[model samples]
Target: MSGKAIVAHANLDPYERTIVVSDIHGDNQGFLETMRQVEFSPQDALVIVGDLLEKGEHSLELLHTVMRRAQAGNVYMVAGNNDTIFSEWYNDEVTDEEVHDYMNHRKNIILREMALEMGMSWQTLEEVRALKAAVPKRYAAELDFLNSLPHILETEHFIFVHAGLKPGPLTEQDRDFCLTAKAFGTQLHRFEKPLIVGHWPASNYCETIINVNPYFNRNTNVISIDGGNGLNRWHQINYLILHREHIDFGAYDALPRFRALDSQEPSKDPLTLGFPSTEAEVIRKGETESICYLPAIDLEIPVANDQLYNYKGKRYCYNMTTYCLPVQAGEILACCDVEPRGLLAKRNGMVGYYTGRYEFLSSDDLLLKKEGKQP
Candidate 1:
């Protein structure tokens, strides 16, 4: 949040593929099980959605796995609110004494209260305690890596946020803390591009999502993969895969080489959100097509030497001789060009343009429902 030391990654191509995981909550075994459910390849990208620490067994092991994957050039991490808090304490951004006091005095009661709220029974509460006792200290290098995490990751087709963005085009000013906080029950719409998130666990959405992670906003492009794991009695671990090309759907119906080593089992109910069971099926499905409800209206008026386009009281000029207009009124105007040179347009005399690399999406092509307008 403070420094450019952690420069966020943004890719112009929205269709770029990746995977997301959430709220590991320190169940290393659950994390491994979740990984087993999804198909991973050397070419694929992996992202940890957040809540990677606190009140879970083998927190250190989970961190180690993240580090290992990152070192192997496939994984990325965003700091969840809890990740941030523990990290702050771990890095002395929050005092060690403060965390120690909380762990000593309020840890058990707090775990029980949260578990009850999350629907854990007394027996499950013991599991949470057992998980806590199994927790080990984190490595210093991993803390540095966590501290260096990005608040947002952008691809050509999708964006991954720790929690959810505040809405609208992402900007540097979007606060990191808010980025990782809760967004329950708000009528938040997914971006025109897909948004992947993890924080809240999903118990009811299994057959669709495979674990505790909720898939509520998948229809709208907001996927929350926090399958509560150690935090919920359900004890599901989950992540998702997006593919460049479609794979077979039949693979999901087949059993895996390994069922979960833990007590957690798949729910009897069918997953309502349409998650493919195995990685191959996800690949076969390709990327989900995003529907943008926003319409495009082009304003053009013919003129001899120079012509102008106006929309919403704004004016833009196109020169038949030298340049194309970059904006018509308030709407963006794209340049038409040949292959040797891509789209070229000038705005406000700055001569703005993109060549060979820019991929433009028409407003009509966007998943353009206004924020808070979608279910």
Candidate 2:
């Protein structure tokens, strides 16, 4: 089958609390702190909504923790998009050429760490490539654990998935969509039970973090808990605590110590994602003073001719020199006027940037756009 089946199920006692988290993205400190705060015990149930690896310095540590808890039968996990990518590598489903391509696209960090732990110093690209070839043989057990993860988890009153499900009977939902879906049509909300998903951040559905105390929803019943954990400056890791009668939020401040590891050296040139040289030249020549709207904050902010400004405590500037602007949901940012070269925005605080026009759309609007339907 193209998508994995729902491999596990659980029936919680009526009085037991189920604490669920999504998109940990390898923040071991944040995960540990959250667990400590919640006083997570073996008796209490913990469900993680996937994306347990990548983009952080402690990917292996985080995976070990989850595997240990899971083995004890206290944790249930549903695979996220990132988890699926690593699974492919572990299963030997990808060729060396395919793995090399993925490594080039800023995905070598995970493999490099694994190689180091195996007593190899992969200091060069070629060494990293060599390590990729040995992954399936060296990490067979770990790969098996990742492959065994289910796509969905269900309770009498709630559905736990890595991503939102399609609008219809739960049994009929596509496995791939449940693992990686970011936008869902209103039809998805018509289902009888509330859904909890994590692939997309809560910022995509709400304009501000202050407004997300209750929950952020593309649909009223589909609550998203991905607090752009490792991806954004302003947002922190978010966890949702579910009770029989109510839900609560558990947020951990970003670990500045760990976040510093992700900082990059300043780039002299503007970052462009596959834009042709000729097209980029045109954008620079035609760049003009424009007022770009901050859809998340519902405010219109003016971009200077060629300077950075502080919005919501973060600095933003339009690179007339380059077409890309580093902006994500829930942050106060100055929008750039790069129409032809395309704008860069962060999706759920993921490592890579998503290239698209400088247009803001909520998850619901995004669903309509993807479906070729009017909202």
Candidate 3:
């Protein structure tokens, strides 16, 4: 997950609002252009949904721009699947060569296949590899920030997630689904809030289904701001503005400002999972004596520390402790670097903070029975 900077007017007068965007995908130039075109006011808050790299010519440039925006306290970002892959590689967990291999494979297979389906000239593996090599080391912080970012954000009236929730026990999975282009069908009206997603490219036939029509149902808020960069058909970026009262939109009709950082596609996995969802849960029935466990992925084994039990599961690694609350199924937890701080989410309810993993409850089976909870 990347760092987010919130910008709002001190008074938040009637016109003050936040602007949300989907999948910049390295279109930093377009992003700036769109902001200028929309006459972005300092009073506005800009939130980028994620997937800002991996398919453009100005990834590093875009990264610098994003950091400047954050530093200026104007913009924030949620980690997209594409951003996840770049983060791992930026952290050196995945090498540049390995990324190139994946991109070459994707180019030769998936991308080419899609191009053929669309009757367009296929982008070659060489072109993709070159694009990856073009990424400079200057964007390291931005990439790390992207990797460390969260999947969802909450405001007074709306909730912003890179990907929407999935009907499962995993919270990250839902976010990942919302960050990709897989399901833009007849089932877009399922979510309760105004879901702003990017990842899926724009399509004429699927326009109504893909993008949220906030005008029809002021309450039925669903928006897809990815204007489909990196293709022969479209070259625009959409920016959405929303606040307590209403919402609006803007678009940038220029080429992308950055290059793809690597050939690897975004990570398909979501980052939020494994914990409680409320402050009350963290405060509930905690023992005086405390222990914590940081869960591990299948490849990483959990190590016990004090009362902490680092639980390595089939999917993700999480921390568990006696001080931690029992985790209900479908809850996603993100451990914080700040001592005694971790984020807990039950389905999609309000996100909560816990002191340690001891508060996590783990039975052989945990069942989740909610549509969406907080943090």
Candidate 4:
């Protein structure tokens, strides 16, 4: 039951257009707003590549939305690693260490979110055990929704899976492998058709620049669409629209919006970005922070010292960043924070640092502006 295939097939022939997005991770407003921006309609097939739940503030709400939309029959979901996390735990498929890792790794976990919704809490193992007992009855509807999700949705032109596939026919791949495969973009595979996947962020493969647009590896015919959502300061919900063999993409973020009043040239110096970051090796230790080496750019930078660790004899920080982005005026950017050093922002769907003046957008309208980039 754990490793078997739960394949779901679709032709998508009836839909006028098809839209694919991945790894929303509970950014319900961003997902809904982007749906509005894309002008999604009932005539369209909305294919979510996976990781729909967990790691954000609104998993339950987002789940409700997807569930409601799915009833209309045009919406399809491919089970993601996170999407099946609930079933994994409830079924006792994970060890205690795995449970600890899950608890410590994410903030705003969906299970805890659901537990809170049911007037319960899960900060410790005891609470989790109690919730496990209560969940089958109390959270039956949500659990059924999660359990019923398929791992693959194959259409005529594309194979939509949350993770990568191994070589073979669609019916041959394991459900868990399809849901948990890592770095399928890097592997060599002879696919029957073009494949689209999430789980691994597109940012991981963008070495020279900070980009999160849907990545197409024409060599292997695999497209990676995870946009670093729910995992970093710079991220978006990436959309991939399909029309026959042609493909189009864009990204949306829930970050604070800013509009530029004046233009500035990009940094002339050679800069390294997102060599698939949020992980780095420590080069030197300091009192409050550590100097770390990012392997992708071969650059060393300072990181907070508190999180450095050794796993299986290799050193890595749980979180790391070396983002420096270019900016332009009159365009909107997703602003992360304003520090004395500079402004942290993401523009044109690329996440990085910007040292420029920008105007803030009113949260309600996203149109009003005020001159500021200073903290």
User: Alpha carbon lDDT of residue 258, candidate 4?
Assistant: 78
By TM-score rank, best first, the candidates go 4, 2, 1, 3
Candidate number of the best lDDT: 4
Minimal lDDT window, size 10, model 4: 366-375
Decide which is better by TM-score, 1 or 2: 2
lDDT scores of the candidates, listed in order: 0.46, 0.58, 0.46, 0.77
**Better by lDDT, candidate 3 or 2:** 2
Q: Record all residue pairs in model 2 with backbone atoms less than 3 Å apart, i.e. clashing.
A: none
Better of 2 and 4 by lDDT: 4
Q: Backbone collision count in every prediction?
A: 19, 0, 63, 0
**Which residue ranges in model 4 land beyond 4 Å of their true spot?**
95-105, 268-326, 363-375
Candidate 3 ranges beyond 4 A from true positions: 1-15, 90-97, 103-140, 167-175, 204-221, 255-375
* Positional deviation of residue 103's Cα in model 4 after best superposition, in angstroms: 4.2
Query: Across residues 248-330, which tens digit of lDDT does each residue of candidate 1 receive?
Result: 11001111111111121222322122111111111111122111111111212222111233434543332222222233233
Q: Report residue 236 deviation for candidate 4 (angstroms).
A: 0.3
Which residue pairs overlap in candidate 4's backbone?
Answer: none
- lDDT by residue (tens digit), candidate 2, 57-124: 78888888888877877788888877876666645677556766665665425665677788764545
Backbone clash pairs in model 4 (N, Cα, C under 3 Å; residues 3+ apart or in different chains), count? 0
List the lowest-lDDT window of 10 residues for candidate 1: 250-259
Comparing 2 and 4 on TM-score, the stronger one:
4
